[model samples]
Target chain A: DTAVSQTPKYLVTQMGNDKSIKCEQNLGHDTMYWYKQDSKKFLKIMFSYNNKELIINETVPNRFSPKSPDKAHLNLHINSLELGDSAVYFCASSQEASGRTDTQYFGPGTRLTVL
Target chain B: AQSVAQPEDQVNVAEGNPLTVKCTYSVSGNPYLFWYVQYPNRGLQFLLKYITGDNLVKGSYGFEAEFNKSQTSFHLKKPSALVSDSALYFCAAKTGANNLFFGTGTRLTVIP
Candidate 1:
């Protein structure tokens, strides 16, 4: 069984277009996170949700929004996608929201190409 | 503020040889360190982590890491590297806020 899964493995859209990536985890983790990996392979956390509550919000632009309908699902929606948005987005989940020892499992990532 | 650093951007090793990827961290209290690997066009996979207890922690796929508090480092090591072991390795440190800070990542290449 896939512990964490992401839909729309690839997304290509023009500037000003909007797109959304869906994520679901069967690990029964309460905390979910969205991360962006740039072309330089630099990974950075964008947002984190715990029990459907927003916990960590980085310095990301307002164009990107993350929504968690339930504890097992977290989705990312980007508005007015730009060329800079061309990168891989990863979704992860941890068993506990504040448990420092919990390991976070990641999904297969979504490659977004903004042309 | 918490941060992790991977000194080597790339490391090449021969197949069947032992390999090590260096990682250092800067955090306030006891550090919560983790190692993750990423294959081409794939998401990050948890390799191992060091929260407490033993200084040496073992993980998946014959991987292990040593946590040295004095040096503030947690380096990943493998006894015998395979060609499939080539991937991008990342070191991350978790903060008190329950957020993780990842390094720039180190690309490992195992030559046959």
Candidate 2:
């Protein structure tokens, strides 16, 4: 079974358009994260939600907003996307426990292209 | 802040030869290091991790990593490279936080 999944594997849209990428996880994890990989293959964390609470917010622009409706879903909505926003976005989830660490299971990622 | 670095952009090896992918990290507290592999057109898959104890850690697909605290490095290694092992490998680290910082990935190409 797929542990973590993202919708719309590929998205091509014009500049200044708005788009949303959906992510869901069935691993019963409490922490979900979003990462953006640029053309240089530098993957950086954009945001993280633990149990539906915003935890880690990187230096991402306010144009990118992440909304977690519940523990199982975390959706990213970009407003006024720019040409520089073209990259692959990945969703990952992990369960956190005291004094124990877990590996993050990633989704198939959504490749976004802003023309 | 915590960060991970993968110096080599790409590492090439023969199918029968051994392989190594170097990774280094910087963190204030103890580090939680992990290695992940991403095949073409696929998501990143977990390979192994070093949370505590056992300086040398073994993972899936006959891969292993040595966590050198003195050098602050966690390098991935494989006994024998396979053509199917060609992929992008990433090193990540976390320090007392739920967020993981990933390094610029290193591409591994095993020549047959």
Best by lDDT: 1
DockQ of each: 0.81, 0.66
Give the lowest summed-lDDT range of ten residues in model 2 chain A.
Answer: A94-103
Q: Chain A vs. true chain A, TM-score per candidate?
A: 0.95, 0.92
True contacts kept of each: 0.83, 0.72
lDDT of 1 by residue, A19-40 (tens): 9999999988889999999999
Say what the RMSD of model 1 is.
Answer: 1.2
Task: Indicate the residue-level lDDT of A53 in model 1.
Answer: 65
The regions of model 2 sitting more than 4 angstroms off are: A97-100
lDDT of every model, 2 decimals: 0.92, 0.90
